[model samples]
Each structure stands twice: as structure tokens, then as C-alpha cells.
Target: MIELTLIGIGTGNPDHLTLQAVAAMRAADLILIPHKGADKDDLAGLRRAICDRYLGASTRVALFDMPQRDPGDPDYHHRVNRWHDRIAAIWQDRIAAELPLLSGKVALLVWGDPSLYDSTLRIAGRLELPLTTRVIPGITAIQALCAAHAIPLNRIGAPVQITTGRQLRDHGWPEAADTIVVMLDGESSFQTLRPEGVQIWWGAYLGMAEELLDHGPLPDAAPRIVATRAAARAAHGWIMDIYLLRRDRDQQAGRA
Candidate 1:
């Protein structure tokens, strides 16, 4: 049976790698790292760095070009499905070439926990090969964001909502929760919300050398976060960021 292990490596920080993740990397016969082009070289580079640091000498590493989603297609899910199919094809070809009989263990290093906003699992499901899969969870961006800010994820006895920037922008703050954490946000969607009683805690490139952090009331912090995000992305050519928003406790109390 072909063993496919999906390992989460945490945010960009090498130190975030768990013992289980390290063991999985060393045990694999081959590891696949996706190349996202020069603009996102750091993504692949970080994977390589981790391999160099932990993988055994007998393990081999392979790089594959990540498939780009077609922006011309307005239907997001359809575009994503096509892109994933292309990626599955690439994975099939690479495995055939690298692990001739497709009998050895292969691993893919994913960012954050595969169970979160990541699509590695869904893409793997499209592979034609018979495979046994396993997952080693890693710290997620939400964990990194909360750690960097030194804050808890939720208020006392309250629910916390995790969402994408697009969702926050399109749906507004969730009525069910006082705390909302936004990820995969390219547009600083927090700006779309009323600033009156909301506070934001934001972090970019969390756990890396170039990490940035900011926090304060939404109205006062939104513009600075936008400008800072733009500047950082220009400087590094890419950035992964997340933010947490909460309605003031007093404000909620007043409403009640």
C-alpha cells in the first residue's frame, strides 16, 4: 500500500515543528515541496530549510510547480476544482517518476493544520492512486496570531468565530460570537466593519524574522494595518497574515 502522510509545519517558524512532524519527515522515502514561483520563493525555501534541518540522509525531496487558479473564471469553486485537478495530475506524475512502483511512503509538508483552511486533503482525495493517508497536525496561523499577541482566543464563556477575509467583508461580523478571527484576507476586510466598538489585533508573517504586529481600536488601527500590509508585501513579495476582532466587553454589556 502507498502511504501518503500530510504533515503540518506550522507558520513560517521552524521552531513550531512538532515532534510528530519531525518523525514523519524522517520516515518518508520522498517528500514533495510545491514551488510557487519567485514571488513566493520563501514558501518552498522554508520547506527546504526544514528538510535540511531534520530529514534523514536516505529521504529524497522533490519540488513541483504549484498550479495557479484561473482568475478569468468568475466562479470561485469551479476554478478551484480545476486547479486542484491539475495539482492531482502533477502529484501522480511526480510519484510515478520518483517512487517507481508507488510503494514507498511519501509526505507533503503543509502550512498550518491540514484540517483548517488548507486544501491539501481535498486535493489528495482526487489522486487516482490507491493510497493510505495520515495527518500530523501542526500549529495553525490562528494559534500563531494569538501567541504573537499574547492573548486568549475567546472571551470568558463566549464562542469564537473563525472566518476568511472575504466572508467578513461579505457577511459582516457574526451575530453569534463576540470574537472573530480572520484569515486568508487580502483586502483588510476589517475595514468593512463599523469601528465603533470593535478592536483588532493583527499580525503579519507571524513567527518569522520579519514578523509585524499591531493592535488597537478598529477605526484607529485599520488604516495603519492596510498601509503596513502593503509595504511588507512589496518588500518581501509575499505575506501571510491573520487578525482577531472583538467587540468591547463594555459595549456588549451596554447592549445587553
Candidate 2:
């Protein structure tokens, strides 16, 4: 049986590895790390660092190129579907080549909690092997953002909506929530929203020693965040950011 474990290593933090994740890494017959090419070599390097720090000395480690997303396709969802299929094929090929007799256990180092905005599960689903999968939860950017800003995700008797940057731009504020946490945002979607009295706590490179954070009223802070995010992304060649926005009807009644 090909047992696959999705180990959540958290966002750029080696310390985010849980005890269970460590054990899983130690038990794996093979560990796969996706290479994102030169511009994003840091991602591949981080995966290597994790493997170097963990993974029993005898365990085998494999590296595979991550397939690129096809932007020429008009249908966004269709493009993503095709991309996932390509990645699954790559994974299959690498596994067959590297571990011909592999059977016991295998794992992939996920950047964040597998259940949160990550496609590893969807890709793994395409494999026909009678494989059982396990997800080891780790801290997500949302959690790190909240902690960095000293804010509570949910306010007293209120709900928090988690969404993508695209939806925030197209649909505006979701009526379902007074608090919102946005992820997988390539653009500054918060600026599109009506910034009246909304509070924003933004974070990038969370958990890393170089983590950066900023927070203030959306109206007062959104522009700064937009410019800062742009500069940071340009400087680093890539960036991952997450933010929490809270709206309070009462002027004096905002609390983390």
C-alpha cells in the first residue's frame, strides 16, 4: 500500500513542523520536494533545508520540477485543473523512477495546512494507487498574521470569512461576515473594498526571521500596504501575503 502523508510544515518556518510531522518524515520511504525553478529557488531551498533538518539519514529524498500553470487557457478553473493533472503526472513519473519498489510510506512537505488553499490533496486524488493519505496540520499564514498583529481572528459573537483576493475584488465585502481573512492573493484586493472604518492587519513572509507586518484602519493603511507589498515582491522576486480585515459598527469598539 502506498501510504502518503501530507506534512504541513507551516509558512517558511522550520519550527512549525509538529511532533507528528517529524515522526512522519522519519518514517517516510521517500519525500518529494517540488522545484519552482530559478527565480523561486528559495522555495526549493527551504524544502531542502527541511529535509536536511528532518528525514532520517537513511530515508530517500527526491526532487521534481513543478509543472507550470497554463495561462493561455481562457477558463481559469480549467487551466488549474490541467495544471494539477500535469503535476500529478510529474509526481507519478518521479516516484516510479526514484522508488521503483517503494511501498511503505511517503510524504510531501506542504507549505501550510493542507486543508487551507493548498492543491496537494487535489493532485494526490488523481493517483489510482490504493493509497491512504494523512494531513498533519500546521500554522497557516492566517494564524501567523493574527499572532503578529496581536489580533483575534473572530470578534465577540461575530463570524470570520476566509476568501481569496479575487473574490474580494469582484464581490466586495461578503455580507456573511464582519471579519475576513484573505489568502492566495496576488493583488491588493482590499483596496477595492469600501474601506470605511475597516481594520486591516497584513503580513508577509510569516514565521521567517524576515517576517514583515503592518496594521491600521483600511482607509488609512491600505495604500501603504499596497505600495509596500509591491516593493517587497519586487525585491524578493516572489511574495506570499495574508491579511485580516475587521469592520466595526461602533467607532470605539474594536478589539483584538
Candidate 3:
């Protein structure tokens, strides 16, 4: 049976690796690295770096070409489903070819936590084979974002909405929640809001040496953050940034 282990490596920091992840890597019979091409990003290289640092020669390492998703497709959900299927097939092929026996453990180094804004689990589900799949949780960007800014996730008993930038752009702010954490946002979607009583805490390249952070009233901070994010992304060739938007209730009460 294919014993798959999804190992969370944390947000771009090698030191964030947990003991469980390290053990999984050491125990793995084969580790698959996804090659995401050169121009779009260097994440593939980061994955290799992690393996090179932690894995030994005994653990067979294989590189598989990652399929690119089609953004021009009319149906977004359908496109994602098709992309996941293709990825699952590729994983199966690569694993079977490298380790025909499939006797030992298999591991994948996941960026951040697999449960947060990642599709490794969904792809694994399509494996459709009887295999023991284990997930090792790691530090997520949300945690790193809060830590970098020295902010708490939720204020008192208030609720927070965790969403994508696309959703925020299309639906504005959700009335049901006082706070929101946005991920996978290419554009500065927060600017679409009225920005009356909102506070923003933003972070880029979280947990890394070149990390950037900014926080203040949304109206004042949003523009600077956008400029910084754009320039940083251009300089680094890619960027992973997340932000937390909170409405200060005490300030709201004062205004009222």
C-alpha cells in the first residue's frame, strides 16, 4: 500500500520544521518534489532546499512536473477540479516508477499547513487507493502574520473571517464577521472597502529573513502596503503575503 505523509514545513522557514516532519522525512522511502517551472516562482527550489537539508541519500528523491492551472477557463471550479485530477495522476505515475515496491514510507514537504489554503489533501483524496495518509501540521502564514505584528487573531469574543482576496473583492466585507484574514491575494482587494473603522496588519514572506510587515488604520496603511507588496513581488519574482483586517469596536462605539 502507498503510505503517504504530508509534512508541513512552515512558512518559508527551515527552523519551523517540527520533529514529526523531520522524522517523516528521515523515514520516507521516496519523496516527491513538484517542479513548478522557473519564471512563475522559486517555490520548487525551496522544496528542494528543504529536502537537501533534511533528507539523506537513502530516501529516494524524485522530481515531478507540476501541472499549471488554466486561468482563462470559463468555469473556475471546474478548472480546479481538472487540475487536481491531473496532479493526482502525475503523483501516482512518479511514485510507481521510482519505487516499484512501494514498501516504505512516502513524504511530501508542504508549504505552511496543508489544511490552510492548500490543495495537497484534495489531491491525495483523488489517489483513490487504500493507503495510510498522515498530515503533520506546521506554522501557517496566519500565525506568522499575527506573530510578526504582535497581534491576537480574535479580539475578545469576536469572530474572524478567513477568506481569499477574490472573495473579498467580489463580495466586499462579510457583515457576519468583525475581522478577516485574506490569503492568495494577488491584488490589493482591501482597498475596495470603505475603510472607515478598519485596521490592517499585513505581512509578506512571513517567517523568512526578508520578511516585511505593516500595520495601521486601513485607510492610511492600505496604499503603502500595496506599493510595498507590488515592488517586493517584482523584486523577488514572486511573493506570498497575507493580511488581517479588524474593525476596532471601541473606536466604532466612540464614533457612534
Judged by lDDT, which candidate is best? Answer: 1
For model 1, residues 1-256, the per-residue Cα lDDT tens digits are 6899999999978999999999999999999999999999998999999999998899999999998899999998999999999999999999999988879999999999999999999999999998999999999999999999999999889999999998998898887788999999999999888788898999998889999999998889999999999999999999999999999876656563
Better of 1 and 2 by TM-score: 1
The sequence of per-residue lDDT tens digits that candidate 3 reaches over residues 1-256 is 8899999999888888999899899999999988877764478777777888988889988888899898888898999999999999998888778867765678888989999999999999998555789999999999988888888999788888899999999998876678899999998899998787899999999988879999999999998999999899888888899999987775435451
Query: Residue 216, candidate 1: how far off, in angstroms?
Result: 0.6
**Clashing residue pairs found in predicted model 2:** none
lDDT of 2 by residue, 41-140 (tens): 8888888888899866878988898878987999989999999999988887777777676566888999889999999999999976667988888888
lDDT at residue 104 of model 1 (Cα atoms) = 93
Best by TM-score: 1
Between candidates 1 and 3, the one scoring higher on lDDT is 1
Q: Predictions ranked by lDDT, top down?
A: 1, 3, 2
Each model's lDDT comes to 0.93, 0.86, 0.87
Q: What RMSD does each model have against the real structure?
A: 1.3, 2.7, 1.9
- Off-target runs (Cα >4 Å) in candidate 3 are 250-256
Q: Better model by lDDT, 2 or 3?
A: 3
RMSD of 3: 1.9
